[model samples]
Target: MPFLQDPPRLTNAYLADPLLRELVARALPGALGEVEPELEHLGELAAGRLFAQQAVERLLEPRIEHWDAWGRRVDHIELTPLWREAATLAARHGLVATAYERRHGPASRVHQLALVHVLEPSLDVYACPLAMTDGAARALLDAGNAALVERALPRLTSREPARMWTSGQWMTERIGGSDVSLTETVARRDGDDWRLFGTKWFSSATTAEMALALARPEGAPAGSRGLALFYLETRNEDGTTNGVLVNRLKDKLGTRKLPTAELTLDGARAVPVAGLSGGVRAIAPMLTVTRTWNAVAAVAGMQRALALARDYARRRAAFGAPLAEKPLHADTLAGLEAEREGAFLLAFRAAALLGASEAGVASDAEQLALRAVTPLAKLTTGKQAVAIASEALECFGGAGYVEDTGLPRLLRDAQVLPIWEGTTNVLALDVLRALAGEGVGEALAAEVNAHLAAARDPALRPAIEAARAALARAEAWLAAAAGPAREAGARRLALTLGRTLELALLAAHAQWCLDHGRGPRALAAARRLARHGIDLVAEEPGAEELELLTGPSADGGAR
Candidate 1:
């Protein structure tokens, strides 16, 4: 059947759709670039590689180890580079896209979801001194000398990675944690040389030879606006220190791979980035990518937890049947599946949008969408991933709680997704403000309509109609947001509605594939989820909660 679910469903669809599979195969780049493997988090491909050359007789290495490593809370990032390098090569060689849609088909989205969770890095790469293991300083000219090596030289149509990681990270200070305005990092100008003073608190402050840092020059504007994006490099021909110091590691809850650190900058020399007082503007693009990645990581966590649970249910038996065979267990599985699909759609659709947008081509509209969606991804996915892992473990009873079962690792790893980048309330407020911007509702509506048209599923008609009504009711709720209480209530409704809109768009996209005769599996999955979504939306609390506004009984007004 045409079940257009997330990865597993997508995998079937991908195989059925020859064109998609071919497209992925043609898209992969062979040798010149780095690569990454998505299976490390899912079925456990990494630990397999480590044990490939086993001394045991007739026993091929276990594939399960790679999967277990994903459960490692803070160290997954450390294992990421190898896969990244390989995956990059495959994409470059026309084997796949960074999303790996070409190679894995629809399943690539699943792979990507896994990758982010496993390689999750807590700090913003650009701001984190621990952004990379190796350190360097780069000034303005260096800012323009980016290492988007594969991206700069493009070929024919395979989905572009649309990755926004600049070969840098420059926004942090000894005083800068959540507040950027109070940064004490100094960049002193000396006839093209801007010397830096101070350090970074939790900068993964690693990557490329040069970094773009936020610095305040002598007698600059008072606050964040006054700062400039300066470039710094590690070397000065002496091979010693360029005044940029790698202080120490950050002991944290999760995302400890790539090394979050306290860095030192003692007269670290740098150069003035172009556009005076453009530090904020210069850094915004980088921040957008980072925030988006953070969101992706959260979604990935959700998918991993869901996948783990799904696998457990299929295998773990209780009460004379597999746990998944039980009715309550089935219901739990269904909920997790629903959450996973919704999150996958959110993550990939955002990536697809960013890929389609021109480089550095950010609009207020786009920014608003990013702000509104990213936090939802973070909050919902992070919290849900934990729950999914825990519940999946419950299916296994005592084994699930044990370290050998690896369920605990999944929960522990997901702990940091929401905390990093920005906290929940911070993102929620941003969503509120962004959605409040003029015509956002209309814009969102247009987006939804376009997706619906693409889905084109006759079987989805009932649910679609229901969803339409739900959207209308939800809109009315938004419109009625007047007082503080009303507005607060409306915001909650809006958030749920927004999530619906996100799912609706993806459901529509999946439908478009089936309608165009792409994959039966995707079509089936889409039908199920789209129908479910419609039902959910139609069940608006407001419609039921409020008394019907009607005239008196027809028989007699007094009666």
Candidate 2:
């Protein structure tokens, strides 16, 4: 045989993913036995067929058909076979349905998210629409909207392909992305029905059957408070456009398989899901749900990239031996592994909290911790995924740069994780807000301490102490910094908190592995992660440096 360029064969995702299995076993021990068979099946489908299709079927992309053959305005987006197949597989496997059904109580979310993690990388970005759908369901359920819930919930969680429906979350506009305070969309009363008139600049799931949007009614108060959550079906019963017009689809660097469109809602009929006042507060449930999805997808992408790189390392020899045998390459892979372990712990912790809270089973302290960790996990894991994906790409050297190799797509897709749900800065501020609530910071610290205490390893003591000291410094910074100063350092504080929590969680998992005879792999991961150091927060910049960083100088660039 010549040089033998073959890589390892892809195995079932769930079976191959020992880390996810361990996390699942730790988080939802009882439910794991029930969810295991389904996950194994989903894993097989994902790793074998879905992975192969995504690699060879490079031309798969969503195309928008804005007009019919007769030149009539008929906006329809065509999905590729892979997208359709993946969507069906997702439904059949109970990805969204499991969460809605809550078959396993709070543990159902862990199971559902784990399934999503397995299927995410090969889902052709179908997770985008599913996220919106899940959020919409949660919002409707929380709002006590019996009518809308009755109509949408069943289909949203439907197992049948013909019956299942995805939802679009049309929040972004020409005004801005995260700042809905600048929303120009207006809602009007017409007899018993409400009409929505607005332009949604960025609506993923253009082909969705319904959408949840924010619009202000006439004479409503200004800012986000005036905005109302509106639920509208995008099409009539006859399958005609229900006053929602798809303007155009986005052509982008990544997630091309997702039909993201600019939409116009002209007199679209809608019903208010929550109170007309404080609509921003009303949308919290949806945001929480979507943010969790965003974090899960982020971690899933990281796992996929690492899986490919690790496999390639064993087969792709460098000078004298396989890349896996090289000390430097081994170190790089281990570093990626450590980052991924922390990310996995953080993301799953958020999911577990979401499940507990949604089930109304969370304690007072747990609820506060949930509030802080949700944003922390979303922002931190998203950034981690992008960095890990970049490193994983480099593991393949030149082949990673080649588009046809299916390696570039990993980086392309990873780029969107941090930007979606919320950007880093936006989420950092959200962390600050969550911490501002009574008992949130203390609850978070308590949770971290509890996890840290689980690891009795003397070597882990230093890392544990460093994490506590970082927490103390964060609390001090938050206590001292005020107004603009606090805002300036929010990202640093949030990162420190997020990283500390992750390290604590990893330590706890390492202890669990040690006690359960699962060996020292997890302990090693925790140790490597700790080596990254916990000194994340820094003193505020000097006035001169702050001014230069914040805006143009007072001297108008003359000095």
Candidate 3:
């Protein structure tokens, strides 16, 4: 037999993750004793059967069949085998149901999102539809529509595979991407319902059973103020298209197996969710839920990338020794590990806060902290996911760039994290919006200080001081900068605050580990992240200088 490079294999996701275990134990206490079995089983599935299946399965994309032999408009979408299997797995595991079930009280969300974190990376972006489904459930529940809630909530949270249903979020249009205020979709009153008529430029999870869409009603004003949230079933009782036309399945760079499509609503029957206006306001609950999912997904992607790279380091040989034995290779992997640790803590903190809020156990400080941290976690982890994935790919040399090796997909899929729920810039501005609320910035600072206070280890003092200093600098910048300057430096400020919080949380968790005899690995992570630069805030360039750098050239030539 010739010498062939060994491919990386995942160990049990739950068993291999000391950080998750420790955090769960600390945060959830006795709940881990009950959830451990389920986590262990999901971890096995992720590492074993699903992982093996993914390795051998041929890459396939969803196809839309517009017509049959009779030339009737069928508009049927055929999904990949893995995706079909993923739906059943998702339901049977109670991935979404667990959160709403509140089996662990305020910690149920922690358990549910933990399952998602473990299984999502192996499921080929099945989390996309799940995120929307979770969001739709939250939105419907918050809308206080008794009829709609009764009809959909049970099915959305059902554990039975056959009964469970997924929903789409149809908000994007050609004219409006993030700014739903510019939505062009229109709704007209029918006999007892409304009919949506417009195009949805980018509709992910097109195969979902239902969707929450935004449309301006007839004789209504323009902008998001006049828009109403509507719920529509994708098909009628006879399993026929519900006046929704699927134009084409998108050919994407990654998540190719997931069906994203261009859709046209030609008189799709719908019922108003709340009222005939404030659709944008109504969808806020949904965005909060989905954005948390986005952050967790980002962290999961980073974990998967790091897992593969680390495994390969032990298996692959260079200079007559395993790559893991090389100091430089070890250092590179260590840096990535630190990033993953920081990202994990930050994302999971958001999940924990959400759980508490939903369970009505959150204090005033936690409520305000949740508002600020949600956007921070999403934007921060989104960027880290891409950076870590890129670096992890490089660890594999040329193999990382080869599609057949299944390494390039890590980077491609990670690219969507920062772009999906919101782009980095959009989320940065959102952080500013959260800060605009009274007491939000103070609440966030207090939360950071609370975490930092838990660390008594002298070895972790430097990281703790760094986090505090970065946070102080960010507050100073915010206090001094005026409108345009603040907006211009929003991204830097958001990143600084996010990274500062991550370092603080990491230090606190590392302290817990040290006290519990779990070793100094987490402390090392905190130190490394502190060294990675927690303070990103800088002086905003003046208007004239900024224009000169970013605006069109004097002669109108491309700069």
Q: Return the top candidate by TM-score.
A: 3
Task: Note the residue pairs that clash in candidate 2.
Answer: none
Please tell me which model should have the higher TM-score, number 1 or number 2. 2
Whole-model lDDT per candidate: 0.49, 0.87, 0.92
Q: Between 2 and 3, whose TM-score is larger?
A: 3
CA RMSD, predictions in order: 11.7, 2.1, 1.5
Ranking by lDDT: 3, 2, 1
CA-RMSD of model 1:
11.7
Q: Which model scores highest in lDDT?
A: 3
lDDT of 3 by residue, 395-419 (tens): 9999998889988999988988899
In angstroms, give how far residue 490 of model 2 lies from its true place: 0.6
Tell me the deviation in Å of residue 9 in model 1.
18
